[model samples]
Target: MLGYPIPANETQRLAALHQIKLLDTPDDPVFDRVTRLATRLLNVPIATVTLIDADRQWIKSRVGTDTRETTRKVAFCSHTIAEGAPLVVEDARQDPRFSANPFVDCENGIRFYAGIPIFSSEGYALGSLCVVDTQPRHLHEDELAALKDLTDILNDEIRLREHLTREQQRRAISQRELDALHRSLEEQIERRTRELNLVIESAYDAYISADENHRVLDWNRAAAAMFGWSRQEALGQSLQALIFPHGVPEYDDATPIEVNACRRDGRETPAEVRMKSLRVEGKHRYSLFLHDITERRQLEQLRDREAREDALTQLPNRRALDERLLDAMARARRLQQPLAVLFLDLDGFKAVNDDHGHAVGDELLRDIAKRLRHSVRETDYVARWAGDEFVIVLEGMAPEAIQGLSEKLILTIEAPIQLGEMSLYVSTSIGVASYTPASNETAQELLKRADVAMYEAKQAGKAQVKIAQQGKA
Candidate 1:
């Protein structure tokens, strides 16, 4: 048993369809233009202008598919004509009516379908102008409007052809039929205009259209919401002056532009503006699509900072420090410069924590972190390796400079800390590890040797500096 939808006025429908005399005709470029425009504008690979027949569906024009017609019972366009409205199947496999349908079950996967009914002046649905995609997707309001406009253009072509033939055979067509076709053409133009307005109103992007001189022509609801300017206030204003007050934009596609988008309150926001060329009635214009990426950019920067930085003392974490270490080793080997890694552990740290409680211990660590960071040169990399321990990388330094820096670290830790209501003091055992172009120590091995020297400093009573035995490759 074949399942299909049939028009109630099948006789009248076929009479009107055959009157156009378009059945079994060669591919017309006029029809192909609508099909091509549908495929490109809607971003779908398959588009067709199918005319429904008694037992078959005929393709007047098509894109992507090789088949010229499909069985009426198995045709999606068959259902489109009966409904007499836009038929959108987001996923045919999910619909009970089409789940077991051969086209939906095929290897290519006919998942998405959107068809706009093609009509005659007598209100008969002759066929459909539709698009199909293998992948499932929902059509936005603007996309639906665009599809409808294309169908309206196709119907206009059909009516235009009928009108020309009627004029040539004036004796065959009644005066009443001629009057009806004239009225239909006028109504089609009015409907096409309304459809375009609907597309603009429902667009998600800040749809800003302007003249060649940059005067605003159309400001959509999205543009008003994004720029804090109502449609009435934005009309006739200079587009560049309204958004980019500092200077005209410098175009780059590498990244979305971070422009100073002047707000209604005279403040600025970081907006990403993507401009495109829009041609209206053979006249050139600009379409600016704006999105406020201020919050997104801030979150991106914060995430990057958090990934590399320690939350405790705001110093570079182990991961960030390792990156610097590898980079420093490469530069040191290239420039033939001396590089040093100083591993410092606070002496008597556990005893101080045990005596003063953990609260005092935390404060002491914070204060120590600040002092150690300030103790090194601005060019050096200082990172807290773990609790009570820190590592500093020094590049392009002489052996004498290394010795003075080691002494400076020792003195800085030995300095008294005024911790409210009393004075506190601590010292750090320092281990100095050096690498020159002549040395054979890898980055990790250098740190291991530095750890060995730090143990040696701890063993020979606390608060002393020890140098690692070099060339341990």
Candidate 2:
């Protein structure tokens, strides 16, 4: 069999094919629908929405076929891409091109074939939507036209999928950017972002002027550095479309906006954008100033995380725990449901730190923290209260269930922990404080009651739970 010839625009065709991003992608129902319809309408044993890669024809969607791919050198669809129209071979045995093809001699016994080239929007014939049968057959004029129509639909589906993926990604990135912009930045950012309102050419911030129609008219040097685009490449491009391909947002306020813009290398980078509308030479024009904000935002997030998280255990620290208690209490009060606070301290934890250095001690604390978190429901809040002290807020738990949960937590900790070479066992003294409107206790007072109960548990020979006395100091 004669090997299929590559198209004259092979390089451009391959580039266009990769731009669609359909090769080797997961099967989508959109492509499946076309292949399924082709199998039924044409009465062929096999139908496939095949994509020709650099070396193979990947079956994007196939009916009645297990072979996912074959070498492009031997693929019938490879030749179809060259035809730029429907390629019909009524009998493989009579066709010189495919007469000696192994597919003709194989178990597939492929004899009749009809393929319509699937062209990309740029007129690159990437592959084919084809039907194959074991027995020799002829497709009528109407059937050939139907195949072409199906390929046209397949082309639309391919283009739609590419556009939708980019749009979904764009929406996700935009949401993150807007969320960061709206959040309260600390004094440093507040001062910087405030003064950044009026950007001068001398400032490092990128200044750009675009027409009201969103076309870029002027770009500063900083703009080139920020977006990875040279002045020549960015000028005359749609500023709005270049920055936000989906569309300019209908912002909730006229304040400055932060967005991740597409760089020349296709990486999205966080940038602050301030826009103003004015008249330049009596022509309505818009000027925008931009500055990269990735580093600043990352520092903000890091500081925010550290402020509320335990340094050693990486669990919610005391401050976060206190906030959670206030919210949980309010929710319980509104619902008229009972909630419990369990305060626990590791029994003989100091002894372990004394015996095995603080490194092992730190690892033990982290391990127990994970166990405490896993033992409770997602609704429960687990936090490190202090050194060797842990607190948990279990909402909607009845008095009857509190003891069982407390016991489970103790037992969970008793399981041996693997810290390096040592398998160490630990026990806990837990205090249970159940909240009711009758008690009228503040969050701090509730925590104090739980702390007292924990001391009582320790007095009663440790490794046990002591429920706090209701309405008692």
Candidate 3:
């Protein structure tokens, strides 16, 4: 049985041990020299720079030993690390802890043992510099001091080996990542090449690709037909001069360059160009994909407008609110200004939906959304939270101003909505909460408080505004 005890903060010690990175490594001459000296000076058959880890004692350098590791429970170095100083046992057979130990009882009987703790610069005991002999021998004070000096040397060597191993592993990992990136780039190039071939074969637009030096590498059938020159003549020509004959003189240097290509019958056609960097055959290159987007640009603009605008009420949706809210919250918090959040819910929306069709109710709700937006300041945001719930975020407002705004919101929604020939009436309940620097609450928590206040308002009356109050203990 081993008498060694682990440190209370063993995790921190082990982390520091790993930081040195000296465990289970190939032999170093720096460590080998000291262990060799330890064997000679201590007059021992075995000398080792032994590191006690979580489960085993690893030999960093072994002068007269063939084994690399031994169980921690039976390791003498474990006791050395625990003692944090030299542990000299003149006779293992007389020492109770080692009397039954295999090293003492077996053929390689250890009667003489002297171990000095190897400590980190920060003073954590890592392992030991130890010497063992079969015959019993006592160590003088001078010999013990010499052993301590030898341990310091071994500690320095272990630290150096750890640093070197970590650096080597880092370089290996970096090289592996670079190799993977290169393979990924090659696969991407092959995939893009196949896609370009398909586009050239089927597309009506004139497509072209070029090297990094701006020399053409690909001239599609459409490009050859559109330009006056055949595919053979246009294969390696300068795209700038050959295509944009009358455009800006420095068009080639301009970013996202646009140009006009001349046809064989002396007709000019418009084209849009985009350039991308690539690698080919171990060399850097660039590619240009051209399109006739004159008519397509109008349709794309229409699509972008539809994407940004809400389809039902034609108002900006929660996505736009999120973008604006981030900026607003940042500016308000920076200035130590207060911002108000209002959670609004329609009082009789479900009744309307059940009585009339959903379509009519939706139209009525859209009318109500327009009214609320018109009532608020242009700087304030009014966004639909869900089916019949909306939220308004007012920036740079005081508590009194927030109270006034919440009341105005309720009054605005309480007014009758004129949908076609019929008049529909609905009420809104609002809960208001403010964000203050003194509160230290998160944005989500503040919003939740506002939501709870809104429910409180709904409970109090059909159409009212309520401010949140902290419940008394």
Candidate 4:
């Protein structure tokens, strides 16, 4: 069997591929969903997200096949990626490229294939999302378009996963480099003192050497610039007074540790500190390396917030809502207080989308999210449960107050949303389900009850509030 021709930029492409480190790992549901969707949409028996490795095609996700991998010579995905575009074969038996291939010549072999190249952010083709069928078939124009759309989604997930993986690798590398530097510096200080001084002067991070009593013995340029003091001013000063005026962390550990560091102006900054002990000319000293980590901390916070927020509405997503529900239930049980969950579903949202467009509908949903947010108190939690649906968790609310709050939310949503010249209107049906200490219901049950009540509100004409009558037994 003839193998697909290797790409001209195969070396660089493989380098980018290996850097993502996705090969032969555990199954990821994020990629699994893409393959599953591809099978259902394309009506294929086999669908896979495959990365073309040096010798094999590794399946990141697969549906309708037990084979996790196949040789690159027999992989249609290999050819698809090699072409750097979509490859569609109506009947593999009739296609010269794969007619003689064992995958097609064997009994009940693959007869149809459609694959789209998945590229890295650097424009290198890394792999492909391909669907396979046992029976010969041709794809309609819409089917091709849908397959492409699914591939786009797969590419997005790949990019996000790659980015997060690279960030983690970078942090690990920084720690390893610091550890190596610490060991090398200790050896250099023991054998050659003058060379150690030159190394500290050219170092990237702030370096300070202090005596056993915490008096600064040596201050590098980085240290002077970081703490707003010249080398002359920092030398002989108390290291604690210069950077740890408020408090000091245990600097006995040789490994890196995170700590709050004070600047000359008394401003605080988070830093990664690594300490090394040295004996110079029979004098005891400690060398400290400080690296500012404010940017890293901020990036971590942003990533955490993004994971818990809905991109469309900037509200707490379903994951966050579930956590909030569990916490609220726990507090209610401890305090012996009452809590309520209000499930809201927007009415006439579909009509608005169909009448105007998705853009208008999106703007309207954002407006509704804002109105719903402002309609409730800051103590209450609002989450976007799904499209056109929201869940609000309220703690320590009386029955009368819960009812009033639900009514207020409905009224607020009923108001016209002005999107430039056009005014859009939508109402919400609220379902109220309260939990008491005696009830002792799970979060899922509470949400189900509220959801059921919401349907009742819809049944009793939209824009009405319906309270769940039965509590958990």
Candidate 5:
């Protein structure tokens, strides 16, 4: 047997062959039908459509054979492909090319061989469609022409198969690209949706959205908690019936209204509500947002009280006392009446604080405040001016009345305060100043005179009262 040299571009040729992606695939009836027809028309015992690869000759279709592949070097179709034409050995025993071939001497003896090269469109001889016989025979011109015609038919089939294979591959690649694009679009939509949800949740003002017929469509956490309703309970319910069964009467055709809404805990909370009508899915709906104003109203009331009362002792402080003193001065000037101011200071209160504790001294001061408040008329103002010092404003009072009230307050605060398991004694020095506003006396001048007189009383003795001279006023 003569050895045939492998082609120089054999590796590239095989690579190109495999690039068509047609190896080791399941059998197809179209190629099988063509091979069957070839065997019957040519009157051959064996026929095959063999595709030659790098290491093996694989049969794409075969008739009258169980084997699908054989070694490439020994395969007759391999030589036919290399020859690049039809190869015919009328008698294998007589032909030098195959005289010593194993097929000639084997039990399944081969005496005739004919093969037509299957050329690809690119002119690469891929394989062959071949017929073999065990009996020596010679082919007539008609028989040879018929075999060539069948080989042409085989070539057309291979071309059609290659076209279909390429088309199927293109379809698969296109489907993959479409799937990837769809996945990308879905991911973008999901990312945008999450960002929108985050913005809605973090908003400071509560926001809610609902479908038509007042059924809840969406509720944020702030909205849920603000109305004291859980998300689960609030969804898909009539907003008016759930929150405000009795509609706010203040909401006329033009004006939006505020109302008290009942919370989950049965507390009535003040809220300002605004509503608007909308259409969804061809039906009417309403959206409502409520703002709770309970804390704001309470703060306003507290501010009013703080404006007129002292923070420390809960009494009328200097600002309040000053206003009343000016009022008394106005009335005194108009009616030719007298007004008086009494200044009192707790004596040895600091010494008591240092000996005992500031807590006990604070209790003592509070007790003195109660006594001082009780000693004055309802019209008079008693206020803590500073630490351990108090001032009293007396309206429409003469000199004798001023002296009498000052003494009473002095005696009241000078009494001992009884603490638990302890007794604390404290004294006060009182000073009185009388003013007839018609005598060109101002409120400040009267206050200064009372301050000076209080110091004089302290010098005279503790627990005593002194009156300012008329010349000072």
Candidate 6:
């Protein structure tokens, strides 16, 4: 009651604990299995996975306990979390921290306890996996090691659950946005349809009316201008022949769709078309609206390209590199060809940033990216993996060719870069790792080998190449 331990980073630690979303949740078998294994392996009466909250220790999984939680001040796991390490109390009755505690002094009191702190991805102590014994007992070295390993497994599982929760929340937000957009679009269409004739003459979109037989009944000035025909010439013309010379696009309902619209000058324009069916004088008629969407489509394409490209260098980003790696590996496996990955790191990049400022450092990186791109064949995939780091995936290349390319890239990166008036010099350390069908290595494994080799190159000297030894799964 008098000696409550609190962590230095209590606030961040509590936030991380709640972010995992395991506190006060239903019992998960995955965690329960680990607790059960701990009880069996450690010969303990109770094994629990406990999360330390602001005022309570919530048990997420338990092997021998009906109680869900206990006050943090009285919980032994609290001390374990406070230490951020494994806490082993061989005899709680003799230990000063638990000698007067109710859980230790009460009938059938806890006498032995061992707990390993579980950490969050950001290195905050979230909780602990603990075992309790009614009789005082000492844990053997092997038992302590086993407990640590099981705690690591729990740490991974907790991180995975947190990641999945974040992904689900992200997807839910996107779905809600899509639904709102759909609703808004429908409302706009309905309102525009009600005020059609009032604004048709001045509206930017082309409006056309035709009978059920597809013969034009009315043509607005916008339609004539869009199709390069006068209203007098457009009226009474076959609607399909006037704009849809390539044939009308498929539009099942009032939803808008993109189609190729033919102009009188024989040019094709991308347009968004919306059709509405109406009955006038007991005769069926179709009203069409066409809006040119060329600029919209081009903007969308640019957005997609930016998503996969690095903004600074206009090179493929890490996301694009990952996709390319997977595709290249699949093709190599199918064709029984050799593939290689060249990992590059700019030497003394941090020094450049510190001495010349990030602006100049950025210019240097862009120059390096360009040089690396030019050094490799156009068929090779070059991507900016991260700041001052690049990855190049090459397929159907022999080991010797890959070696030559890596050396060339090193030399190419060593050249002076002119940033306005100042000429900056930097070199690259290159690592080459190859993969074949017989190697049975994953894309990540291959990249990791190359990265390790690059570090070796850096350790050996500033500007050099290191080839990675072939690795297996």
Q: Against the true structure, whose lDDT is highest?
A: 4
Please identify which of the two predictions, 3 or 5, would achieve the higher lDDT against the true structure: 3
- In lDDT terms, how accurate is model 3? 0.79
Per-residue CA lDDT of candidate 6, range 1-473, in tens? 53678999999999888876788788788999999999999988999999999998898999888879888988998999899999999999999989999988999989999999999988898889999999998899999999999998999998898898888878888999999999999989888876776699888999898888788888888888888988888878887789887665665465798898999989988999998888999998888899988898899999989999999999999998989999999999899998899898998889889999998888888888878778888899999999999999998988877777778787788788888888888888988898867777888999999999999999998699999988885
Sequence-dependent TM-score of model 2:
0.50
Superposed model 3: Cα runs more than 4 Å off: 1-4, 9-28, 63-69, 106-108, 120-124, 173-217, 221-473
Query: Which window of 10 residues has the lowest lDDT sum in candidate 1?
Result: 247-256
lDDT of 1 by residue, 1-473 (tens): 66988889889999888888888999999889999999999899999999998999999999999989888887898999999999999999998878888989999879999999999877899999999999999999999999999999988988897787677678555666877787898799789889977887777767888887788998999888877899999989997678777765754445556676888778887787877766789997887777778788899999988998887878888888889999999999898888999999998779778988888888888888999888888999999888888999999888788878888888899898778975678899988889766667788888877888989999999688899888554
lDDT of 3 by residue, 362-469 (tens): 998789889988998898888777788888889877788888877887888888888788788889999887776655566677778888999999899768888876
Q: TM-scores for all candidates? A: 0.49, 0.50, 0.44, 0.57, 0.48, 0.55
Task: Give the lowest summed-lDDT range of ten residues in model 3.
Answer: 245-254
Listed per model in order, the count of residue pairs whose N, CA or C atoms clash below 3 Å is 0, 0, 0, 0, 0, 0
Overall local distance difference test of candidate 4: 0.90
User: Residue by residue across 33-72, what tens digits does model 4's lDDT show?
Assistant: 9899999988788999999999898999989998898999
What is the Cα root-mean-square deviation between model 4 and the actual structure?
39.9
The TM-score that candidate 1 achieves is 0.49
lDDT of 5 by residue, 304-330 (tens): 779867776778877877787888889
What local distance difference test score does each model get? 0.86, 0.86, 0.79, 0.90, 0.77, 0.89
Clashes in candidate 6: how many? 0
lDDT (C-alpha) at residue 150 in model 2: 90
Error of 5 at 187 (Å): 3.2
Using TM-score as the measure, which candidate wins? Answer: 4
